[model samples]
Target: MLGAIVGDIIGSAYEFNNTKRKEFHLFTPKSKFTDDTVMTLAVARWLCGDKEHRKETLVRHMQELGRRYPTAGYGGSFMRWLHNPEPQPYNSYGNGSAMRVSPVAFYAHSLQEALGLAKISAEVTHNHPEGIKGAQAIASSIYLARHGATKREIKSYAEEQFHYDLSPQLDDIRPTYSYDMSCQNTVPQALLAFLEGANFEDVIRIAVSLGGDSDTIAAMAGSIAQAFYGIPQNLASYCYALLTPYLRTILNKFEESIGVLTPDPFDIERFIKAQNDDNTYQQALKEILQGHKTSHWIWYIFPQLKGLGHSTYSQYYGLADTDEARTFLANPCLNERLREITNALLIYKDRNIERLMGSSIDALKLKSSMTLFDAISPNDIFSKVLDVFYDGKKDRNTLQIISKTFNGHISNN
Candidate 1:
């Protein structure tokens, strides 16, 4: 999915200025994300929210995101379709259907599901058989690649199912290939690029070297290449930095919804149980806590606290005046962790636990927000600290005693 966006941005500058050779700068000042990137994200957003796969839901989100970027190089007919008060399929067979359909491959649980969702995504505007077929072919190929299917298996499936000529070599087709918008002309060529490339970068080069519809072609090829080779961190980061905040948020939400962004519970538990020595435990806990502040692991261990909530659990040693907690809370990392924890708890649906976690995080945020210049209320601080750090056995008298202890500690510090 990230590879498709990267390919679109890299190839955007070269779309009009055709190049038959693969040798060129991968990115330039003129490079930008195009309609391919926009529609890909739109599809992802729709999939994230629409678990039921409703056609109306897909249409609404697609149009909403599409309208947000009206000048992102959408074709004339498609642009009109986006703006129409009541849009309908134009029976078009443009490769737009395939370019935006990559996310379906990752979102679907099975090949059949991928094909079905791809068809639904395309038919909103591209009701043409070729357009729908193009989407299904790309999505199915990606589905196979993701599930560890060999190139031979993918080639055989694509050829037999969609009747695309998968036998053409890139060398054979490169010399005469020209700009093409038809799915039949474009989709097979894009697949051939993926079949022939050595890596993700090579796939993009092969698609662009064909000298036709560079961005969309590379986008389709890169979509498959991503599933096969996986995207490089530097390239993925660069492409992500180019996206607007809204798009980035949607992308993160989609990834988390699919469990790609969330840490595996088994892995977390394994790490926790693997510790032996105090130093090893402290270091491991720090690393895990640092990596996933919003993780349920924090809550899993929260009720068994000994000292400062974040520091005591993360580090074996504790600091006075809750300096470590204050420092972490002031940084963006803590805020992100808070959001992640809050979201997880909300999804977990345990009202009592959610309320405790939410209130603790909110109090910590508020405490961090207060400045030294502001009048500090002991009661408020005491209540918040007690709420967060209290173990099961602490009564109000014990809590108040601990609070006074904290108050004295703060005054002295």
Candidate 2:
């Protein structure tokens, strides 16, 4: 599903200025996600949240997101449909149907379901048989590809089911192909691009090189390519950073709902277990655990949620890099939590542990803001009281005031 967005962004720069060769840059300063991505997310959100798959619900999400990103290169008909008080299908056969229909492939459980959902998604605006067929053909091809179907099987299925001529090779189609908006003209060429490519990026390059409706063609091909080869981690991360927070949230939620999770780069659970098994660490943990469970300590150390057996934080929070570590260190809850852990372990004076504590304390103090302190009070006022002990700079009166504040916060919690 995200491959569609990646392709859209990569091809956006070359859409109007067609490039008939595959060696061009994948992204330039002008590259950005287009209508293909916005509508793809809308369909994915619909599949994630709307169990009944009602057209009214689908229409609401599409219109709502479409209006939110009004200048995403929407066609005249779709733009009108977005503004309409009561829009109806325009019986159009634009490649928009296929461009936005990739989500259906990921959301559906079977090829039959993929075809059915693709039809429902398309008929909201593209009620034309060709439009709906174009969507179904793309969705079904993706479904087949992801479910271990060979390229031959996918080509045969698309040809037999949608009657698209999959016989033309890219070399035959590329030179003469020009700008085309019709699904029939675009869908088969896009599939041919996918059929010829060796990997996900290669498919997108092939589609873009066809010299017509570059973004949409690449989106359709990338959808299938992703299902077949999976997206490269670096490319996926790059594309993910381009989305707005709202769009990123929806994309993450939809992927989570579909069990398409980020791969864990490290064995965090094993690390935790190893730490737990160390007698020195375990003894220190027991003293400072303060009636709190190890789970609480775990949460403080690794703030990201668990997924598919590992921490998703490393992926979503950008925490795997040293540069990004500073961002997490600035997190108030994490800061306070780490402070509590380090403070508790302070008495042990284990050289390695104390060194880590010293560095963490330094970083926290450097990044600390009054807002972080203020935020920590409600969630963990106890940490505030301990700070006086750690600093040894608070006067007796300040200690008294902090103790009172801590007692009050404990009661509130």
Candidate 3:
């Protein structure tokens, strides 16, 4: 959990750095926690509550904390769900799972129980499969790490279990947000950040530098790193005053359940134990962890986030980077034109109006359509939105034609 805290602080500083180097203050008077911390507190608070149905516990706690900390960036769909007379989950699969999964990992008596609780807690808000998968992956990794799994063992299991491409390199993820948001992508990457890390601070630097969902990715990676690496003496020593009097008590409650953790330092042996004859393990390892490759947008997006105001994140924070602009997009309603290829193909591939002439799917339902034009107007919103996005200098019809042609490369049916 403190890993999440440290990740929050570390990434808080360099969220847009795109590439990482460890040279900065660990936390600041302005280095406050985000929804990542608040929701984590919610999960931790409820896991220790009455042994009621896990979903009920989660809803109650999430609702309570969300109201208590209404200002922290929350996904919009979730916020709407929160105020509705009867809350029902919107099938969202954002990075919320990765951020709030640690409490179960440390608290569960066994692996199965930890996984079960992680699943239940995830479903309370994120009904989407990818969301559930992402949460489970993070919690399981935390469980393995706490129970004495080595970095190699954790990486191997994550790769084998989820088929993640676990490359530890962070040079490419910056400036864009296009990686898969599923456990297959998000969890393993976060773990690899810790697995390849040298210490608590290293974990955050690696995660934020890797980009994609920078803050959440770093926060998730940090949560796991805390357990594997243990809190830094310097950090815990100095973190005392960062919290409000309220959080100080919360930390004590957080520690109360620490007694139940049962780490089995030998789990790593299980991986190597197969080394005796399982020739297949090597091939499997290669297949899953082949390349932890990432793209370049991870670098650019950080600057965009930090540069949103008169102060760049680095300038405002008096640190290298600390932008919180993307927090507004937490609502899950505002679509960033960015997406993982898998998700893009699933939700937006042919939904565009450009494809109406070339494809069969409904074009009116495209999110871009909603953003571009209101149906109340007879004018084609698609053409108008294109004109605006590109400036009125370009022909609206020509832009629509261009969008269709480019979209064809990605759409087959």
Candidate 4:
């Protein structure tokens, strides 16, 4: 799956100290992987055993795995449930589902298969509806990336399926966005990062900077990014060199089982080789931008990209889409209720748009969003957008600079 170990380990130190800064020590004594890592490895190993038997033995093994990794930073209630001597789900709604669900997607080749394994993985501990939804959203994202989903399609899928509104305005979600132990908030927002990302690396940055349950959020976003971006050679090498040998070995074995011989030897050559099939989308994106630049929304939306095209830039510069011009519009006011918000997020996954133009995302808790308005195309967004300037004029100016910088990167690249 998508760098589950990397995600868990990276997030280990920052469960409470969520920050966008990338300068933190990766492996201090305080920096340790949590139950998320433990459970993910367990699932990866189990999938290497048998795919069809997933349902029959997943929960049994999960319970055992939880016991084996007892002090791996589990929730208090989860620990209590784990220690009960019998396997009874405490019915969690935590981000744990989103944390440890990469293998479900990796092992299952199809969407249906992926979701089935996701259901199994979730029910093992997080039997709540929200837990299942998070797992499914993350799992579906991984599966889609493997199938070659566009950035817009992936974000659209996640927002629709998980009820994420990727408005650059955190205020939309922040006032009600809390640290409660449920996958509903964490998974959806994490998906928001992945959906809006221009490439793989930014997915991690967006999730990391979004600031709630930072590690898992970044981890989940990173997983999908890896699936789509296929990991760069240099960064993958650094990640592998820093990872515990045991983890490196586990990943090697997992890759082997999936018919991939070299998993972590990512290098510039390998990245270039990997992109032998990438076509000229990056180039095309640059052409779209013209002169219109990216907004602050780009930072949280697109984290690790080098640039965009003028055409790509111009397309996204269009206004945000609103239903005011249409007759059959979605119910935006539904977000007044949490259930409506949650339900709207999940169902929206079905409308994976083929083309998205403009900066306008369907921020309302609606069931689906078709482009009524768009300020930019998907390829030009970036993470610098998370800066959160109070001055509206500066923010627009900043987005334009980012957009130009983005296009410049594509042209130069």
Model 2: residue 34 alpha-carbon error in angstroms: 0.6
Query: 149-177, model 4: which lDDT tens digit per residue?
Result: 87778778777776766555533554444
User: Which residue pairs clash within candidate 1?
Assistant: none
Q: For this target, which candidate reaches the highest TM-score against the unseen true structure?
A: 2
Candidate 1 lands at a TM-score of 0.65
- Sequence-dependent TM-score of model 2: 0.67
Alpha carbon RMSD to native, model 3 = 22.3
Question: Which candidate order results from sorting by TM-score in descending order?
Answer: 2, 1, 3, 4
Better of 3 and 4 by TM-score: 3
Q: What lDDT does the true structure give each of the candidates?
A: 0.69, 0.72, 0.55, 0.54
**Cα lDDT tens digits for candidate 1, 27-104:** 654577889988999899889888898878888887898787776888999998888888899999999999999999
Compared with the true structure, what per-residue lDDT tens digits does model 2 show for residues 105-214?
Answer: 99899888999999999999999999999999999999999899999999999889889898877898788999999999999998999999999999999999999899
lDDT winner, 2 or 4 = 2
Worst 10 residues of 3 by lDDT: 317-326
Residue ranges of candidate 1 with Cα displaced over 4 Å: 262-413
What's the number of clashes in each of the models? Answer: 0, 0, 19, 60
